[model samples]
Every structure is written in structure tokens, then in C-alpha cells.
Target: MSGWALRTEGLVKTFTLHLQGGARLPVLYGVDLSVASGECVALAGPSGAGKSTLMRCLYGNYGAEGGRILIRHRGETVDLTAADARLVREVRRETLGHVSQFLRVIPRVPSLDIVAEPLVARGMAPDAARAEARALLSRLNMPPALHALPPATFSGGEQQRVNLARGFAPGYPVLLLDEPTASLDAANRDVAVALIREAKAAGAAVVGIFHDTDVRDRVADRLFTVEPRPEASRSAA
Candidate 1:
């Protein structure tokens, strides 16, 4: 438990876009990050400051321009930068969990399936997955009768809770949350924060990108901020 769960060294990322004028842009200039086992770290920054991009890099959604990402899995250390998509997916599905800025739910998939997806992905039997999902949903204060319903029509807070239940369903050891409480009202925000604390208590290493100061203060054991350095104007001497 003393070892790090995730570590990144000299991580870098850039975005190049083709416009009518075709210009390139640069983002994420060599970031170094590390999260200890069972630690809760908050990533906070202004808009367009690359917090999401950093998450993407850590999760292997986007390849870093230059750096290494190391993930500790099942008593072994693996360099995520060198792992294939299939391997990354395996780690993501089994050992690492992610909650997105926007909830991504299938149009026709039932809420139970959404929560059970992680366990099923890890090859648990359908019945077992359903049982676990139900327990998690109940822990979120979800009504037992509504466990079978599609969550699209639920309130924003309910939807976020469903999202939480799904991400936590498999009990993945590490969780990366992007604005997990972004859409909640005051009361619901408290619920979301409590759930977050529960995750940390259950020994999951959690990194959350927070926009709200209160949310950061509530859930963060450590904090990070992204700042941009000013580019001095060029003048001929």
C-alpha cells in the first residue's frame, strides 16, 4: 500500500489541427504526476488548461508525445505507454476505473446493465454481476424498484449516482473521475462527495478533476493546479 498506484514522468501532449489556415497548437508541456496507493488527488485548473487532456493521457486514451506512464497491476508493474490497446482495455476494465465529464449511457441499455458492465467485462457471471450492481445501486440510495429502469430519464443527480455505481461496480483499484459532481445541486453534491469518500475508504486510488472549490476541498487529499506561463512578446533589438 505504500507504493504508488499510478506514476507519470515528463508527460507531454500536443494537438495539431487542420483548419482553413492549418495551424498547430501545443498543450500539456511535460507534466509529472504520481498518485500513491489509496490516495485521493484533485486536479484543478481553469478552462482549456489540459486537465482533461492529462486524464486522457493517464488512461491511455491519448498517447503522450514524450513520457512514460506506469501502472501497478496485480502485484506487478506495467508500463502503460508500451501496452497495446487490448492490454490497456483489460487494465481499464479490471483494475482501473473512469467516470467521465459527461455520462455515456447506451440508448437502450438498462441501468442494471450499465452498473454490471464492469463486472461482466471482467468475466463475472451475469447473476453475480447483477447482484453486485444491485448492492452498489442501493448504496447510492437508489430505489430498489428503479434498478431495472433506463437512467436516461432520471434526474441529473440520480444519473450521476448511477454513473458512480457503474464505475465502482467492479471495485477497480484505481478510479479517475472527471468533474464527477459537475451537474449536481447543493444537496446532491453532498451525496456525490460522500460516495467519493467511500471510494477512497474502500482503498481505491482516486484522481478527480474538480471545477468547484468546495468539491476540491471536500474530497482532495492532495491538490494540483495547471498554470500557463506568459509568452513574452518578441521585439527586434
Candidate 2:
């Protein structure tokens, strides 16, 4: 309910290559960023610069090694970095929603049902959930015939649209999007951009990784660049 929906201070993350003798690879180092309700913050960086990693840390998908991932929910600030699994799940269910670049769902579930799941979980009637999902899919230009089929057989762009529909359906207070426009054509990309702007106008705090500069320019209120840690700093740590 505050001006800032999310903030991170000196956040850090490292991945261990257990398959390769437990070698450590640090992706994010001391990242400090914030996003406010009614604002969209785009993550800008070259490949491998940890933009996606930082987003995941915000969504509580990746555990940070250091620093704070603070989220404002229902007029209280919660430290996502230190929150337990139950708390994290509760927050995600009620406040934060995420759309990864890939669509990972049950292999046989219809696309409509997949998109309706979040709304249904939030206590919306099943009929209303599916109706909203259908509307979103139509806006995204998904064919009506494909709505009842599993997205597992859909093309990458189609699957991404389904992912977008699902992510936007919940209308959570905070949303994290990774490459939302990555697989869309110009027309569909424009649709995606409009949907993002609509979410902003509806007062959702958005943090996203948009490789498409035009989409980013159109939707982002500001940019947060994620830079790789210097070798000297890494060696010292």
C-alpha cells in the first residue's frame, strides 16, 4: 500500500556448479533496486549480466546469499530473503505474480485452464476465471480453436501468450516478467505492451526483463541496469 512496492539493498546471489566440483558462480552482487506501484522498472543488461537472476530473487524463486529483498504488502514490509517457504508461498499467492520466459505447466492441461488457475486459486468462481482467461487470450490474438487444447503443442509464441494471460489474470499487487515480448511479432508485441501499460495504470508494481527495446521504451517508467561484478570484487569475496 506504500509508494514503493518492492526494494532490495546490497542483494547477492551465487550459483554452485555441483556437477563441476562445486565451483561457485556469482550472478548478482550488491544489487540495489526498487519499484513503486503504478510504475514499471525494466531490467537492462547484456546477456549473463544477472537481470533475470535479480528478478527471480525478488519473486522468492532464488535465495539470496546476502542483503535484503523487502516487499510491502498490506501496509507491512516483509523480507523475502529471510522469509520461510510458507510465508513466501502466501506472499506469492496474494501479492506477487511472475511470468518466466518459459511456460512450465502440466503437460496435458488445456491452455484456458492453465490461465484460469491463478484466478480460481484466489477464490474467483471457476466459470468467471475461464471467462476472464478467454478474454485475455483473445486480446493476445490467440486462436479460439486452440483455447481448449494443451499448450504443450503450441508454438513458442503461442505458449508465451498463454503465459502472459496467466500472469496478468491475477492482477496482483506486484508482477515480475521475464522477456514478455521475446517471442511475439510486431502486432502481438504491441498488444503485450498495451497490457503492461494497463497493469501499470491499475497500480501494479512491475519489474521486468524486456530484451525488446521498443517494448521496454513504451512500457518502462525507468531502467535498472544489472552489471556484472568486477573480478577484483569476486576474488576478494
lDDT by residue (tens digit), candidate 2, 112-148: 9999999998899999999999999999999899999
Candidate 1 TM-score, true structure as reference: 0.88
Could you tell me the lDDT of residue 100 within candidate 1?
83
* Pairs in clash, predicted candidate 2: none
Give the count of colliding residue pairs in each prediction. Answer: 0, 0
Which residue pairs in model 1 clash with each other? Answer: none
Query: Residue 181 of model 1: what lDDT?
Result: 83
The TM-score of candidate 2 is 0.96
In candidate 2, which residue ranges exceed 4 Å CA deviation? none
